[model samples]
Target: MGFDPSRPDIHLGHVVGLRKLRQLQDLGHQLILIVGDWTAQIGDPSGRSATRPMLTHEEVMENAQSYLRQFFKVVDRDRAQVVYQSEWFGKFSLADVIGLTGRFTVAQFLERDDFAKRFAEHRPIAITELLYPLLQAYDSVAIQSDVEFGGTDQMFNLLVGRELQEMMGQRAQQCFLMPILVGTDGVQKMSKSLDNYVGVEEAPDDMFGKIMSLPDEFIVSYFEYLTDAPVEGQTVNPMDLKKRLAEEITEVFHDQQAAAAARDRFERVVQQRSLPDDMPVVSLSTVSGPRWSNALVSAGLVSSVSDGKRMINQGAVELFPPSGQSLKITEDGRFEAPEPGTAVKVGRRRFASFQE
Candidate 1:
């Protein structure tokens, strides 16, 4: 399928679609991605209201520079062809645009739920917006893509390609729509704009912690979609299952060593109620007596200072000294690291063990 690889940061939501691409690649099928540098200008009309804010040429170029990095984390990129849609669509003649549009009717465009919803509520729908799906379909004809993959929300646009392929005297591309993963809120689709996404570039510890915070109901679905782990008919507890799911995903982006360390820390912090014997040590040149929350953030144990406060409030941040005595750090005051092998917990799932 003509998928957009122009976005800079790939997130877990994209991993759902990439899984299908990986499957095809492993089967020795050709995989080509049309980085929608062109369609993105008009914006994809699948899920948005109004027109998307267009990217500048410089912005598009920058995103394309690193766009393929995370993709190989899931698929064999050496077997894939990555092209920019700008190569074809950038030079499309006015007559070419007209011919493509003439292939589809106004009724067909109006039937799409995104357009239908907007039209029903009198939201502005540009005529140019009607051309987005057609151009995406045209991509299939241009490249003669054998199979296309997209999220279920994009079924209409994916079908548009199938229709165009048959009309243009080429074999219709088989469309595979993968299931969508709900965001951390467990309600809406995961999106970076929603601030509910886990970026591919996120630290393993942070990613592990975020996954652990998901609702118990999402564990099985996540295991099914995101990781290579098998969750079919296992009678294990949901929380334990989620930990395994998180570990597999973390292993993909980070080294197996890091994933193991994060898992060990998670178990130590939450399950055993003990500190990790081999926790990472970060050196501070000077000690001004920074707050415990600040120390946790500096040690990469938490996402934010506010998260630090929440951890302490929940009694998850524990400090222990070499004397084997555990200390609780509360919001009202800070605790000193009394000796080597001191431990810090930012939450039940994330802990930092330190020695000065």
Candidate 2:
């Protein structure tokens, strides 16, 4: 199992492969987690239309530390061996590099979809990009991996590893590819950069809410990839199925008690249109004006006044008065102050009430 420290957090998308690693570990196979400290500098070009930005060694190391911390949440740290590729690549001499390169040709490199696309489009392919698959192949050779796990996009690189391993007189390793998890948008692949990712570290309520918000069509896939819950023969409402999926996933990251509590909280606050028992209260003593955006920021509902304003314009900002109907704040300029007991709801999971 190899992963690059390109980001600091692990999302549900990465969990698919991690779960497979866990299954293998339980079957008495040794799990080797290879942190691509060296390969990340070159950046894997697979599934990319343009060159990826390079990360400094410091940034890569920092992300690697974060990756290990979060990785242990799903994988048993005691049974896994963690290694950095720099241990071998840093010691490679010019002759070693030449020897490695001599085993492959430019024609074979260009056969890669990423390189072929660039060549056809008259795009410049970096020499380092060409070397990425080779280095990745050498990783398996260095570790003498018997089996490698990755996403479908990495099939080419995984095959390269097998080829390189056989060239070095080692038995060819088997490749296991996991399906790409769809993002929250229900369209593209799940990614943090796209802000459509549900991180494994999110609060239980947040995790529950995000899963519940997914398109009805994704319930089955979410259950199949993220949980061991059965959905084969029984027919259930999509909403109920989604709820079950959300609770199952939340329980895996959290606990059964937390997952149940989150579900109850979501039902009370969202489905029932009632306030949460533990909703945060904000003191409005120093705040002036009926500026809903500023009040939202003061309550810590939005990150900034500008974000509050954007939410307001997007019709996501709502004011629920204690005795009256909930009012949606549409316009941005000054307005009358919200009643003392009014609770502000922002997006799906955040809520806060004003106090004197």
Candidate 3:
């Protein structure tokens, strides 16, 4: 019962609303996740400073597929009812639009904070854009949702749904607004456009590293919402809390074995410690490619080639020879087979093995 289906990656802001929905699901309420395909065309302007770019049907369909994949990781897909609103909204006629428009007044629409701010600053608010909230409201009426959930920034749209339900002679749905999760930048909300989000489907170590790299200010919110830790009345250190948060979130997407390994890897590399014997491993074929740096990047052991080189120069990249001997990698690149179980290390963080 919300908008913004463009990117499927759910950040902490989304986790908040989904958590509430999960709670209701636990309480035996009817919970449905409306894809909002119909509404996405108009793009919700609830928290936006400028108009959002509209997506084509093909692009929207592709992104929607990715969205559902990551969505089920957190929510119980077995008990969940997933639906696309395009069936109803996409078929609405001119009479339907006019009839729905009669439900609210322009004065009320202009009264929204984002719209008012944009209006005061002489920003362009598109005519079609104004109907977004009403369309979202219609979603609630169509589904007969008992409650609609959204972020604090989405208060206006959530209220619209509530008002629409009441006007349609149906019971008003309660608006549950969760707070936005500040992004890794510590200033803006976690967003794909800002490139600050940690995609849920990221590899185990990648997820772990991203979580560990967050600024100190974001620890509390991360702990309170992202992790399963109970933070109600407990006094906790930010460092310990982030570590726990990282572990819990990692375990959700990865197996416990991998989560434990990622924790150990992060500790050894970032905390200047030593790697545990059972740390996770990545397999690389000797004939798959050339050069250790390129191999490591291909295996996702490093963020990029530049990052791999930086780590190598800093004495972070280590090569294990066939006879179980470990040596530092050099710029004069050599392509050779490693011993039976030889491995390569990038910053004591990422590991890869040479296999025939």
CA lDDT, every model vs. true structure: 0.78, 0.89, 0.76
Using TM-score as the measure, which candidate wins? 2
Pairing residues by index, what is the TM-score of model 1? 0.79
**76-186: candidate 2 lDDT, tens digit per residue:** 899999999999998999999999999999999898888899899998888888889999999999999999998999999999999999999999999998999999889
TM-score of each: 0.79, 0.94, 0.78
- Candidate 2 accuracy as TM-score: 0.94
In model 3, residue pairs whose N, Cα or C atoms come closer than 3 Å (at least 3 residues apart or on different chains), thus clashing, are 322-339
> Which of 1 and 2 is the better model by lDDT?
2
Could you say which candidate leads in lDDT?
Answer: 2
> lDDT tens string, model 1, 259-311?
88888777776678766565667654333346766777778877777777778
Give the candidate order by descending lDDT. 2, 1, 3
Model 1: which residue pairs collide? none
